[model samples]
Target: MEEALPIRKIIHVDMDAFYASVEQLDNPELRGKAIAVGGSSKRGVVAAASYEARKFGVRSAMSSVLAKKMCPHLIFVKSNFDRYRELSQRIRNIFFEYTDLVEPLSLDEAYLDVTENKKGNPSATLIAQEIRQKIKEKTSLNASAGISTNKFIAKVASDINKPNGQKTVPPEAVLGFLENLEIKKFYGVGKVTKEKMYRHGIFTGKDLKAKPLEYLQEHFGKSGSYYYHVVRGIHNSAVKPTRTRKSLAAERTFSENISSEVYMLERLETIAEEVERRLTKNNVAGKTITLKIKYSDFTLQTRSKTLPFYISSKSLMLDAVKDLLFQEKMKNSVRLLGISLSNLNNEKKEQQPEPEESIDVQLKFDF
Candidate 1:
């Protein structure tokens, strides 16, 4: 008989309304109030919203005007990246006390692998609790966590309890846990994919598992294979310690729409400078330059050019962006403009795959 593979213990930690929470934490009067972190201008979008604001239908990525309409009493605060970064680093430091295998998804969320950790602890559930407690103690902020055998399930489970809580799915329970979960709760199934799954009578994990690999591939293409394996609790992606920076971008939404190409070029010059600064800070150069444009009516368009050689200078990038900008006439007045660089020299050419393991034995733990 083949020996059963060891089940990996992974945890997904996500801070609750991280940006808004930090604002509230710093200003005592803002606590328990509906607050959003971003500009409150006519063209402003919400970067984050507190739970109180969320109750009123205010959400991140929502327009500030709509958010105010949803909650008239909502307060808007500017983003302070320096403070956010400092706090994020402090929280990350706490994670290293237990495990070095950490993958940060953003300023507010990360995945950790602790199968053989520095703590020498056996229960991932307990580890999650301890980490959350430490975060609360150190940052004076609430966090939620999910403990499971893989990153995907852990990420999904972390949302079950919001603000300050955690959930654990042991190896034996993974299959059943996934089987009963709502299709929308699957970590990677976004709005469009959820609607597509719904149309195919796939509203739950069980429904997804019933479809054959061939049928899924026909429907979902490359992503179909991912769905097939993950629903069976077979995600093999590890918590990578270092993640590659795929692209760098800078963009601005104008207070008023501008139709002049001269004005557009001027704005593009500033955006290119910001991109160049970021590239210099990261010590990287890219061959691909993409210009993103959002019209007054909210329709979006992108133009891209890839050079034979990498370039990081603002002047060179501006020249390339100029070509893309004038390559097509403006369909409408522009409300937003952005420039991004990709195909970086710093990106790894190949990635070493994590060893594959299969679980056969039931995990015995009190979660």
Candidate 2:
């Protein structure tokens, strides 16, 4: 067996209800209300929901019909991709100050390897606090972060205290943390896998770890091996910052709206192949894949999922894309379909954005 790498400090930063928060940030009227970013058409799906909306069961990829049913006064706002993109770039700039090994999962989340950062900060936890502080000052937006010895734990930790909070799992606490983590909370274990694991009586990481490797492989196929290793907190994937954070994205705006899920899959297969070619041409691999859809009314939605390991193969990318497609049902005619990948190993950090000036920030991050 290959030996594990020495423990390194990693931080996973994710903005809290990013798009909805952005809507609230720019428009003060919507703060602390049930709001989502997407068209209000009867055949539209929500792209993102505010924390307040989430309390009422509103969620991304959910139909507006259901959202309004859940929250009778639900408010829908149009998405502004250009503004979101600009804000995302600003967030990445803050990350670059700490380390060049910043792997952007999307416009709102990234994994940062801060073992040896530019700030010369000794404590990764402190660095996470500072980054979150800077983000608030620069964008007036809240962020949550996870800090730990590896990417998997760090990513999960960030979610423990969400919406303007931070959580850190020390190296000594990694195993204990994993043992207590619910099986459903494990990264990459979607609904189907969760059900399968439940059938196997694996309700927590502890139970998952109890299964023999061969038994898992027999029952879960190749992914069975994947589950066996994760329960042990053995994920060794690095925080990869590619030469460019701009991923290999292929998009098509249909001449006419497409509402059929079957037709959408056909287009996705073609787009995934194109993304695969782009990754191959760049000589890189991506562990995270995203699917973007635009409704006939011009409102857009994006859904993404990350794998534990990097992939450049066309079929593999297609597999993930297809998984994303079925995760939600279409509520409207789709006018555009796009697929992209990030987490490349060669991404570099050369240009950094300027943070907002004339702002005073207090260092009051909780433990």
Candidate 3:
């Protein structure tokens, strides 16, 4: 008889209404009211919404104006990223206590591989509960958790009982759980894919599994293979520990759209300076500089230029963006201007001292 694979235990944790909830927690007056966290201006986008606000059809990334029209009395609170990051670090510290195999997806969510934990605890479900309870105690915030044998199912399972709850899918029950899941609930199946699946009569996981592999691959291309295995409970993606910062960027949406070349040049110089500052603060330099422009109509475009050597100085970065901006005439009035530095090479990682709070840790376990 052949030996079986070791079943890995995974947990996905997501904070409820992170930014909006934090606002409410910090300010007692904001509680029990429909509130959103974002700029309140006409062009401002919603970053998050409280549960009460969500009931009013308000959502993140929607224009502030639309959100207001949806909820006439929606309270808008400006974002406090510094405060959010502090809480995020605290949450991450809690995760590190359980296992070093913690992968943070954002300031409010993470995936943890607790199969072999520092506490020597065997039940991932119990660990998740402990973590959620601790988060509530330490930060006065509620978090939901999903426990499963792999990251894919854990990510989906986390949503079963959202906003201060958890769900678990054991290895033996994984197939049964996936079978009844709706196609819309699948991670990669977005609005477009959901519509396509519905048109093809693939409304549920069972419907997806019934389709032939060749038919799926032909219809969905590379993603078809992904769906074919994931719906059948075959995802084996590991919980990666190391997350490299891929790029350093800074951008701003203007209060008003403008088209003048002279005005744009001035804005690019300012944005480039901010990018340079972030690159310097992060102790990274890059060979590629990308210029992003968002037109008034919301259409976006980017142009990148690669230098022969890495550059992080404000002047060098400004020169590159200036050229990219002036290289083409205005297509439409520009509403947003941004600069990003990519192909990052961190020289300080080896040649110089690390940042005061910098930590690079990895652990290995018996497989």
Ranking of models by TM-score: 1, 3, 2
Please give each candidate's TM-score: 0.90, 0.71, 0.82
lDDT of 2 by residue, 1-367 (tens): 8553345788999999999999999999999899999977766789999999999999898888889999999999999999999999999999998899999988999999888889888789999999999999999999999998768889889999997999998756666788899999888898889999999999999988899989998999978766777666666667768525557789876767899999998888888888888888888888889999999877889999989999888889888888888888887899999998986776665332122210111112122
User: lDDT scores for all predictions?
Assistant: 0.92, 0.84, 0.87
Measured on C-alpha atoms, candidate 3 has an lDDT of: 0.87
Candidate 1, residues 1-367: lDDT per residue as tens digits? 9776556889999999999999999999999999999999988899999999999999999999999999999999999999999999999999999999999999999999999889998888989999999999999999999999889989999999987999988878888999999999998999999999999999999999999989999999978888988888878777889988999999988888999999999999999999999999999999999999999989999999999999999999999999999998999999999999999998876432222543435466334
Give per-residue CA lDDT, model 3, range 98-212, as digits (tens): 9999989999999999988999988899999999999999999999999987788999999999989999987667777888999999989998899999998999999999999
* Cand. 1 Cα-lDDT: 0.92
| Clashing pairs counted in every model | 0, 7, 0
C-alpha RMSD of candidate 1: 2.6
Candidate 2 ranges beyond 4 A from true positions = 1-5, 243-367
lDDT of 2 at 11: 94
Clashing residue pairs for model 2: 241-347, 242-346, 242-347, 242-348, 243-346, 243-347, 243-348
State in Å the error of residue 282, model 3. Answer: 3.5
| Pairs of colliding residues, candidate 1 | none
Q: How accurate locally is residue 102 in candidate 3, as Cα lDDT from 0 to 100?
A: 91
